[model samples]
Target: MLAQYLLGKFRALVRLLIQCVSPRQVKLETATYLRGSKTSELDDEDHNVVEWAFSGAYDGDKPILIDAENPARSLSKNKSLDLVTRLSGSFEPGSTVCLHLQNNILYPILVLAILATGCKWTGTNPACTRSELEDHLRVSRSKYIITSEDHEDMVFDVLCRMDEDIELILFSDVTVERPPSKDGKHPTLHDLLANSTFLPLESRYQRLSARTAATLMASSGTTGLPKMAIRAHGALVCESRSDELQDAHKPYKIRRLFCTPMFHAYSFPKMVINPLRQGQPTYYMQRFDDTFIQKLSLYSITDIITVPPILSRLVDQARGGDAKPLLQSLRTIICAGAPLTVKLRDEFIQLFSNPPQLIQEWGMTECGCISRAGDLDADMPTTVGRPVAGYLVKISQEERVEIPGGGFASELLVKGPQLMDCYLGDDSATASHVTSDGWYKTGDVGYLDARGRIFLVDRAKDIIKVNGWQVSAAELEKTVLQVPGVMDAAALSMGHSLDEHPYICVVRTDHGVSEKEIREVLRSQLSRYKGSRCELQFVDGLPRAASGKLLRRKLKAQLTHREK
Candidate 1:
């Protein structure tokens, strides 16, 4: 493993060096250009060509010119300059092209535009929703979206909803929507691609700097509406951004993990993409199932990124002596989305006995992964670790907010390349939250210790005003989950009455545990007022998206539907 990692790095360093000094305009290493591949046997020409490709071949291994005559032609010297003349021209820095994958066919122009000049391209699936598709659309500000015959409906939906104007064509050709008596929607992605002719990329678009914003992604913000976050082209300057690397501080090969869906900003950036940039394989669960998660080792997985809920299931499975060796094969396991409690942390450490290190990360949609710590695996006090590179963070207390260190527990504000440019076209809402300077108001309640570890308390939106006091729904939910039979809990203020009391409901698990035991557990651990202020209800499970985010609206709807 070490040999493979070192070889990959050595090749990358060589490639970086060649790009700076040599004029490499031709050739690519079809296999070696990727981040971390297991195969080693290759010709000497492939090695040097990979080195040149990394430096200049289509802006770093995008496969523009391909295996041309005499593969080692340097772009600077006359020998390579001739090859460059034969090949495509340079690309703008911020162009992030979207590869609309259809069956196995690769479109020629789509390949040239993306591979020609180091412009980045990311592949997408057809099943993505309009809002889900918009994240990538907004994140990447994608140059062109290539879609097949069937997926144009979703693309049109997003284009209609977007505030920014975007140029559209199809993966197949120019689309012509069959008119309903000349009054119908336009043609589809397939039609557009099939009919479109090659036009020179506008000259103005060719000179963009790499630091310029290329893409954007949206997430469920603390506000009721979705907020867009920017993902700059510069974010991928390094082959392996250290922040997303495995804890060993090594570029580990990312293999398979299916617990998370691709649509989530967290999973898309951290799990799926970070690895793909490094050319590692990622297998998504598509959907999660306990027995399948328990049997993952059969497929030879090396890493996994998950939240507390999934980790809890792993512990539950491990407690019964199942999935032991499978987990033993694991390299790095990351956790976020909620705090990893000391009780649960200790249980994992004791059971795994020096198994995969648990990293508790703290981040939100406003920015990507901010902090992570290994102390979490050892049962250290919970705090989202220090900020990663290319990011700045500050915590300040306003009138309604409070933190332990005077300003320690205030709203966390972040500014970084990964921050979104704006929410589509909602300028008023975007201007209201993002400052003139660039600081985004996170609306998150957290305190940063002197060492920079952040402890999240709750969302400012989820804060419950009770009797002139603020009660954190997170605090209540944490306590409820500790109950022997409780699976999940969510708390929302019913409405502020003159009486000012908390109305909390806990969803208890039916894992053969009784409601009497659950309520008794809460009563024994909580104060009389706190204990008596809540009701216990047995539920199958809390409503969640494929990405494991709670859908509070659905929970509220479920309560209303049941009441009726």
Candidate 2:
């Protein structure tokens, strides 16, 4: 440990000396460096000056989010800036806005404007059901919702059902007929932007403290409702700046293609900020589908910011000799949001010539990015690398249990500036996850190597990863229990790795209800991914403790024993 510490310090010293002597010029494009970054007037107010600089960092005129529907369709950074200006003037300062639109080019502008106005912003996955969306809206307490004609029906349904006092701001062309406001005019997002004569200078340049809550995002919960996490203004700024600095040091420009939901924290930086700062174009996917391989070759995508399932599909495509030419253009591929199996990673590397830099990042909604493993030894395919810059990692063994690799497996604890303030409106949940001093309990059971690389073994919480999306076991269990004959149900992951499928074990009450009927009921309630590929088992009884709490581990053991 002492030797490793000394070696780390020595490397740091060498880097500092090299930086001092060489003094490399900041070579980032206009989007990263503001033209008027050094203002003489606000020199006295350091926080205000910092805010000005942070806002200005995204002032470039380049296209940020490109429309996937039409390759020619794109939105420039300036258009977003104008919209932000208009939005600031339209809404009260420091107000919270919930953006729940489909993957569109306008998302970047909305995010920037929200941050610039010193207001809080929250967004939900468009795939979320009205009930799920309602839960998020009720928790966040967002009065203004920015959606489009595409999701108008669903959004309106949520609004009507909840009876929450919220305003709808349409971004695209208004196709739905609705009653006008008391002012007797149907106002759209475009109308607001078109009518604005000048920027709302006051709100646009509002001086916000670093600790102010900038984003209130939701967790991909393993149980119950999704927990809201408040990300501070300083945390966002720091992460963006870090990306900028990293890009400055890179030799080649990054033309990233983003298809993940814009609301997700994993996708936000890559989709909106990182590509913008690098002066590189970001192509937004309407959805990840069969057309993805076509887009890669069509747009000459240099980097793909996607999940494991997409990568697995790409690998399968390569095996069929379809993705040879286009795959070469990809220099880097970032996989996150769910675990990437060693089999998938190895196949990806073997299939491509000059294989893309495969970077596996581990993070949750509450914490932006925890660890990223860029370079890994062939033997250590499970390694998630060390903690990212400005984060610390330590394993807190809840119980002394032997691990497979001759070590004790334990829960991973993280401490970082980018860690969330708290789970919004859920004091108990927040308190449980966050320690008294600082450490955030990442409910991931993993072991650290001698070199500090993290290898995940199991989940402390019961969550199923389906195609890189988190499907809560409890949530699925709830859906299964709703079936007519199901007295009790428990959901678990069927596949070992990337082929993860949600499987359910059920205790039936009625004799007439068949497995097919139960499946049909579940299919009606849950999404396609969660409903399909689900294997059901009729169990005589569910393993439970005396207090009626589930003995999941014991049930899993019984199932494994039966399979053998």
Best by TM-score: 2
Q: In candidate 2, how many clashes are counted?
A: 0
Alpha-carbon RMSD of each model: 17.0, 9.6
Weakest ten-residue segment in model 1 by summed lDDT: 30-39
Candidate 2 lDDT score relative to the true structure = 0.70
lDDT of 1 by residue, 174-221 (tens): 112342223224433334333434443333224444344433444434
TM-score per candidate, in order? 0.52, 0.84
Cα misplacement distance, residue 102 of candidate 2 (Å): 1.7
Residues 316-390, candidate 2, lDDT per residue (tens digit)? Answer: 788877566668677677788788887788777666545556788888878887777764433355777766656
- Per-model lDDT: 0.50, 0.70
* Candidate 2 TM-score to native: 0.84
